[model samples]
Target chain A: MKGISHFLAGVAAATFVPGVVESAAQGSYLIVLGGFFGLLPDTLDFKFARYFEHHINIDPDPANLDPQIIANAVAVEIDRAAETQRAVRVQLHNIPLGPNRWRQYRIRFDAERNEVVITIGPIVNAALAPLDESGQRVARAKTKAKIDYTYDGEMTADIWNGPSFAFVPKAHGVEVQFLPWHRAWSHSFTLAALLGLITGVLFGSLQAGLVAFLGMSAHVVEDQLGYLGSNLFWPITKGRSAGARLLHSGDAIPNFLAVWTALALILFNLDRFSAPVQNRDPLLTPWVYLGTTLIMPALILIGVYAWERRKDHVRREVAQQADIVAELKETEV
Target chain B: MLSVIPSIYLAAPDETSAFIVLPGQKWLLERRGYEAAILTGIGSLCGVIVLVLLSPFLTEVARTLRIILSPHFGWILATVTLFMLMSEWPKGGDRGPTNWARFRAAWSQLAAGLLTFFLSGLLGLILMYRSFAPVPVAFVNLLPAFIGLFAIPMVLTNLIMGTRVPLQHVGGSIDVSPALLLRGTFAGSLGGLFAAFFPVVTGGIGSFLAGHATAQRDERTFIISQGTSKLVYYAGGLLLFFLPGLQLARGGLASMVSTIYTPGTPQLYYTAVAALAVSGAVSFLLLIPYARFSVRFLARLDYRTVNLGTLIVIVALLLLTTGLSGLLIAIPATAIGLIPSFYGTRRMNCLGVLLLPITLNMAGVGPDIARLLGLA
Candidate 1:
């Protein structure tokens, strides 16, 4: 679900096709296309799409640094979207305190309470190291409609940039979509196929086209396994489909599994299929290698992750019942 | 050793020798300098064990991979080049007069990076063909250029900014876990071996790839992995020098060593591995005092004065080593190296000096390109 996982998955997908590995051994760059296309969807969304989005900007003022005002502004948008039925898109920008310094803050929409919680966090340097000069405080504002913002923790506006949210009116209430510009038309199967066709024609090789198509689709499929699926169908269906929720996108174990599994597959393919039988001697032997590198490690890590997630779920349930909105605590060195 | 994290930043070539220490050095020195020294000492002992154990297996894999990937070096190099160049984004220009102005300002960082790469590449090409440096000193010809590109700019920056070195605290213990260590070693080795084996792929690139493969978000993991990566990349690259079948030169030291000696034997290779393990432990032992000494000594000195003295020594050495001609090369290289800091671009682009020329040669078009530019 991480960018690297998607990219590596694409490269691994290319190795599956016959002749691709051998061609790589023969000095062909067709394999690079796999990684390029694999990372393309996310690249499109983050690098280009996010910049072009039309959103109501909530540019915080470092001079005043008011949390109550910011909280009410967010509540008004969620309420307006619920009552008006027109999706309201908002972008919260970080407040710059000085050169390479920012006034950090947090904004979380509590669904159960129908309130937007705002917390003024510490002023942090470029490295997200709090300057120790500023103190933190909290504020809250009520909304008329049910707050449908979904996230496990508060969105911290620090260092690089801030987060965005789209309050779209659903049957239940206004659903808050984080980074509304992401995973839309860019993650489409339709676009992948079209691009594959064009690439094939341009390269005069069907294999290149297939690799391109498979690489991008691999990303879409991987995302489907996470909490938030991409807009796979894209033009055919306007919104993302519900994901399997097998894992969180930011979870470390699943990401490591994906990366290591891809590496194993690549090494195996490189040794097994890259050359003739007489010359080739495989380093990554069949089942034995897979059992050791892929199977055993993956089994142990996944079991641990499952255990941890269950514990986290129980803690979350307790926290939710208490009606306490949790904020990400800063660590002191 | 080359790396982006766990110390060893680009444009600050000083990190290469102490890449493992540099990344965490600031924090460690500021808080618990003594603990870092002790742990790294033990880490060296562990490194020796890891290297000795991995030697036999790594040698065989290296031999085979070389045979398979030798011809494909061009594309592999190109892939790394493309990935690095494309991955960079706008660091500034969030506010400007017009849309186009902001767009251009944002793109300036990328442009600066590209300009640095191409310019360094041009410098590499010029140095490769021209006899600016005397033939007697030709073996160490690029020394001045390297110092200019990687080392001098950092010193200059420190001198210009009137930087200060703060007093360090020496703590007794460091808090860490076995799992963290294992993860760091695993990730570091993967990256180091990848860089060590690849013809032109630097350790920085290898570590970058490995970092992505591991998906490590934790700061401690980053520090530990890069520490391991330096050991593997530097030692592994050198190990290739004595490999029975695959005696290829890489990195500055190995390439220089290759000029005087040629090694090819299984027994000798094993001996080198043993020596590496032993020397690694010894060096780590020496590191504690040296690191402690630096903290103590630097605290009393002015950063500007130190940087100024280093600049003088570097220039004097360059002049003495290759005469005035090396200075000729260093001038342009230093100017080119300064681009990254001034324009807020990537220092890794400075690697283009070696990467471009080498990639072009492997692709069999270096001559053609040089001819076009009248350098051939």
Candidate 2:
């Protein structure tokens, strides 16, 4: 199934790349159309998923990991007060700061038992560590937070409403945007892959995994090409920018014309070699059309061949297993 | 339209299709205005090839000029290809190279290869004059080129076998015959040329008629019951023909005149329309009763547009060819000529599949290599 996806992708690339190149002077819109076509299936599925969660409310929480909070706590640094003033143990407040208007908070809770010890580490100090220790630092921080806030409202609020936005588990601080800082990182890839894997497991096949991964990845990639940026390297960088500029909005016309040209070439010259426009006659764009037409058919054939081979291999294995079982039965007799 | 000559009579098929389906017709015709775009693309591709090959002899900027003018080039290729196809009569046993060898051998003692070339050129001229002038010339120009490229190997292979016999099955045993070999060779060469040029012309017109009949039949089935008056059938046929012809001829006499190659008056469109009107009225009169019988006879058959179109086209072509043979005999032709001509035309129709792709590609001609060949 994974092989199938790779094969389809190859076919698409083969057919579409030549088609785009043939119409290259026309512009990027044609390529964009190809990209959109690639992502069409997943986009439809994403809508379905959205409807299921928001409308039907069947399993609204996408994480589907830990449903109940396990622990909640607040720290204290107060002396006893009398009368009108209660004991001032701790204060909790959200401090607003960044471009996302993200607010940070710090609070301490009094412990009833010394058995449950408290530990606090430096926030920015993890950046100074060796690469191996970096994971440990983040893990340690998250684990502590999980233990402290799991049982309470603040933890639920943060879980449901943080900068992190994903249908499945994603690293903290990742956000969804039309333009992401990087590509395929942050929230998109992880959630898509995880969901797909889960779906495949439940379905007893890998098709779901392929679909999930392709759809999610395409979505992220599409956004990454936008004017604003995406958080492509979520775990690595706590930064986001508006423009990483892989594509822009001005390339619509040329793309359309190019596609039309490609379709024409495909229909007309199913077999004959097209004139190589770039190499010889610039006016005669045979090679481009030829390449475009051949790519899909060739890739499809390759995919079919590989699939047949796999099927044969499976058949052989089954036959061999049957033969071994027969021998064992004969020996037993 | 040919009926005005009175001597130019057409044979009616035993049964006409109430419906039709043409190969590739649905894809081409139903594509909105974009059908032209697709046609242009195919045309450009073919045209561009010729342009590039001939660019060296033209201007330095010929290469650049070719791309911009590719559509026109495509049209030229399509048109020339069509002409090449129609010039030959396909023989059942002869394939091109193999047949050419026998032709050469039959005249070998006279002048050897010189006679063969001379005869070929003469045949080319005859074909040119009969079909209109320029078309045959273009066919001849392509003749030497095609022979050099493809026929030489085939001829050599045929010669080594001692007898230029083709594969034939007889009495449960495989055998070859000289006559069969010649027939195959002739058919192959001519068929290839025809297929390369006018796919639609050979079968398309017939197919279109059949298809129109089928569409009408389907529409009729919805509108009335089989128990209805027989006149309904004729009416349906008339309606079908008139609408399509009118739609096709809306540009009028200008369109009809354009097909003449040598331009005359602008009234040719009116002539065609008028001719069509007369034909429709006559066909309607003849077909009314038959249409009623067809419903009962064809009750068991499913008459979709495609099925009707196919049946109609085959029947129409068969009748047309037969009628042509009949007309050829009126003056001085022998029985041998009539029978052979009928068979040849029927066999030649096998080449009809090649036309539409070639022709549509040539429409709206922007740039084409056929122009250099003087075929465009």
User: lDDT: which candidate is best?
Assistant: 1
Single out the weakest 10-residue window by summed lDDT for candidate 1 chain A: A324-333
Q: For each candidate, what's the DockQ? A: 0.30, 0.01
Model 1 pairs in collision: B7-B23
Please list the residue runs of candidate 1 whose C-alpha ends up more than 4 Å from where it truly belongs after superposition: A277-333, B1-46, B92-105, B129-131, B214-216, B258-266
Tens digit of lDDT per residue, candidate 2, span B62-105?
22333432423343333233323322211111111343453343
lDDT of 1 at B48: 58
What overall lDDT goes with each candidate model? 0.71, 0.26
lDDT tens digits, residue span A1-333, model 1 = 666677778888988978888877766778889888888887776556656666677877777778988998888988889889999999787788765567889988788998899999987655455676556888899999986655657778875457778899998888877667767888889889988999999999999999999999888888777656667887989886666667766566777788889877877777788657327565556898789878998999899889877855533222321111110010001
Kindly report the docking quality category of candidate 1.
acceptable
Interface RMS for model 2: 32.3
Worst 10 residues of 2 chain A by lDDT: A151-160
Q: Candidate 2, which segments miss by more than 4 Å at Cα?
A: A1-281, A284-287, A301-333, B1-254, B257-346, B349-376
Query: Which 10 successive residues of model 1 chain B have the least lDDT summed?
Result: B9-18
Model 2 residue B145 CA deviation in Å? 28
> What proportion of true contacts does candidate 1 retain?
0.20
